[model samples]
Target chain A: MSQSLDTRSSPGATPGEGPDATRQASPAWRRLARLALRQREVSIFLAGVLLVLYFQFSNSAFLSTDNLANLVQFSATTAIIAAGEVFVLVSGELDLSVGMVYALTPFVMFFAAGAGLPVGLAVIVGLLAAGAVGLVNGVVTTVLGLPAFVTTLGTLFLVNGLTLTISGGFPVQPTASGTFTSLFGASPLAELGWAVLLALVLQFVLNKTRWGLHTIGTGGNPVGAAEVGIKVRLIKTGNFVLCAALGGFAGVLDAFRIGSIDPLAGGNDIMFAAMAAAVIGGTLLTGGSGTVIGALLGAAVLGILKDGFTLLGVSAYTFDMILGAAILVTMAINVRLSIWRDQGEG
Target chain B: MADASTGRELLRAEHIAKNYGQVTALTDINLRIDRGEVLGLLGDNGAGKSTLMKIFTGFVKPSSGQLHFDGKPVELSSVSHARSLGIEAVYQDLALINELNVYRNMFLQREPVKGRFLGILDDKKMRAAAIEQLDRMGVRIPSVDVPVAKLSGGQRQGIAVARSVYQKARLLLLDEPTAAMGAKESALILDVIQRLKDEGEMGIIIIAHNYAQIFDVCDRVNLVEGGRIVFDKKTSETSVEELTDMVVREYREARRSVQAG
Candidate 1:
């Protein structure tokens, strides 16, 4: 890194002009390249495209309409949940119970409907229950001054146990009307449509709303936020509620699409996948930066990888191994790129 | 307008004193700033200017004192309470969230809303207002879109000052506004302060180490030493050299006392 800096700082075509002037004097293509590298989502999008091209070349059936539809549906599930996770992550907190909430929400809806509540009202009750778990997560984390990781980790196990007990350790079919199911996930395009719509709205909120702005401020500098009267605790707690609610919503859609609600569904696997998607999409783990659309693209990338690997006859175990390696490689690249960007800016 | 000439008090502190356990931070401080007046507080480090300012901004409470704002005796509970009563401060740290953009920082807690049900932020309006204010203050920057962390220190300070000015509070407390600035940046801020003084609407209390800057922008200057106001004089009556000599004498006396001890 020192050697690279030495070379970068060495006299170029314009001597003693300072970094800003030299940056401006650089060739247009070099400037464009720098801009592209600076926007992490753009690079991630390009990587996704490259991956698609590689898969399509390896197997002609990779781009088949039926396969593409399946890819969209699968990616949409991760994307919706990940979008919500971005809010919590950007607000400098974590919600490990999201996956458990996903598993538990469907059962809550099933039981509520079984108790003779209207199916629509049951779904609302389920989302509200998920939100309640988040509220607990928030209250415990903030009011009790516990780290979000510990609070949510405790909730994760408790929620999982609750799901198991309530479902009597059995899978149950949902009692939703055909119209409701179709609107949510039963139709081929429904989940993807919902994902796209949610992503757009969430992106707008993150960029152009007071809540989004405050969340960023809270994560960026909690002391500063509080000093400026940004309601740091309320912003963080609200994000927790939103994150769990979105996770529950995504679970309901997935359950309807799959035709059953299982206690085992959307355990650690989906949670990890969604988190990976968020990271790959350029939301910083350390907080204060996020992108919802990037998450959608990341989910798409993961979906493509899964579909392509299966088509190429890779085993599930091998897929997991490959996914782990991919995450490490991507993270390493992200760190390196950030270092370069910082150097350039500094 | 008549208060401008009569020095009608905007905020008054009578016999204010503060102590941190056994250590006294302020002692029998009597300070007042009138409408349309700029009061410069000059002191070495730990001389209680900041503590007094914090008391005025409600970040700290005086152990024994009465604060009167606009002739109303009130107890200030918190920083927010002070702000709600139209007292705003630009502290030395500036309290800016580095990840947010300039416009967002400018409109941090008081963002303009335009949509239904927890209305969305009006970014375009904020952006335009921030730019216009910065331009008016002669604080130049490339754009309001980039994160504040990317800006230079002087630029960040400029944004902080501009934010307070745009808030248009009744009283503004600026702590070492030009402390970290260069000649050019300091000039820009001094110019803004001069403009505010010319407007003659808000009361400003500035803390500064630079005697020249205080004389350049302040109507009256107060010298703080050993947790007390040692000297108070109108700018026309006191020279920068006199203030510098007074501070130097205090430093010499303190050194002699330490050696004797």
Candidate 2:
């Protein structure tokens, strides 16, 4: 860094001299390489492409439309949950109870169905139940001044236990009509489109809405945000609620697809995937930066990895190793961009 | 406009004092800023200018004081409440979120909304307004799209001033705006201060140690010594040398008294 500064301050360049006279009159290819390095999202996208190509090369069945659609369906729930988690992550907080909420919401809807309520009403109640859990998480973390990790971790086990006690550790099939099934996860359209649509809307909200802008500001500088009259606590708590609601929505959708709501359907594995997807999408674990489309692409990368491994007859344990390596390499690029950003360069 | 000649009061702080447990931070701080005037508050490291400013800005409640704004005595509930009453503070840190873009930081909490439900931000309007404010401040930058982290120290200060200005604040409290900048950077900020001073409607209180800068942008100056106002004079009436001489003499007398005691 010191050497670069010294070079930048060197006295070789002069006024009225053309661009060629500058010290940075290196090859165009070198400049192009720097540009590629700076565009972290493009690099991540290309990596995803290469992964897809590798899978295609490995098995001809990998690129089949039927198989691709199946892969999207498999990745849909994780991707959806990840899209919401991006909000919480960008706000510099974590929501560990999302997986537990995921399990609880569907059971809530199932209980509603058993009570002879309409399926639509049951789903709304389930989503609201998830939102309530999110509210508790938010209040405990922000209002009570507890750390988000500790608060959500406590709720994670508490919610899971509540779900187990309520459901008596049993799986109950949910009644669903054609419209409801097609809208959530059972039909062909819902399976692939829900994740993509949610990702698009969430990305729009994060980038183009006042709520999104405030969320970023609140996460980026809580003190500054408060100084500017932003209700930082409200934004953070709202983000937690939104994230949990999305998680519940994913679980409900999955329940409709599977035709049964299990007490132990979404566990630690689901939470881990959702968080990994958010990170893979380039949402900073350190907060103050995030991307919704990045989360979708990250889900795609993971989906491809899993489907490819399954087809190649690779064990699930090796799957974690390769996935971890891929995430490390992509995240290295993200860290580089962040470091340059901190150096006050555009 | 209020008559500056007759000493019209835009804000008046009467007998403000702050005590933190056993430590008396500030006592006997009586100050007032007239409309369309710049009041330079000169103080050393612990002379309590900041404490007074914080009290005035509602960040810290005075132990005993009465603040009358526009002739109304009101207790400010919080910093936001003070801001609602048109009191804004620009800290040396600028209090900008470095992770957000220039336009985003400019509109941090006060975003323009257009959508019916949930009020989506009118980003187009915000971007144009940010550009206009920066242009008015003479803050040249590549674009308002980059995060504030990409800006220089001087540019950040200009943006901070611009943010307060755009908020239409009545009394701006600037804490060391030109503290850590190069000659050219400081001159640029000085230009901005001069611009604001020329607005002739808002009151500004600048806390700084730079004597030359105090004379350059301020119409009136106050010397704060030992948590109290030692001298107050208009710029046209007092020279920088007089203020510096008084400060030197006061320091010597204090040292002698301490040694004798």
C-alpha DockQ of every model = 0.72, 0.66
Model 2 chain B: weakest 10-residue lDDT segment is B1-10
lDDT of the candidates, in the order given: 0.86, 0.83
Off by over 4 Å in 2: A1-40, A340-346, B1-7, B71-77, B210-213, B236-242, B245-261
Find the number of clashing residue pairs for candidate 2: 2
Chain A TM-score, candidate 2?
0.88
Per residue, candidate 1 scores C-alpha lDDT tens digits across A28-113 of 53454375566768766867887898899999988998888889876898998899899999999988899999999989998899
Interface RMSD (Å), every candidate: 1.2, 1.6
How does the DockQ of candidate 1 come out? 0.72
Pairs of residues at least 3 apart in sequence or in different chains that clash in candidate 2: A210-B121, A281-A294
lDDT of 2 by residue, B193-231 (tens): 888878788899999877676577889999888888888
In order of appearance, the predictions have TM-scores of 0.90, 0.90
Fnat per candidate: 0.85, 0.80
Candidate 2 docking quality: incorrect, acceptable, medium or high: medium
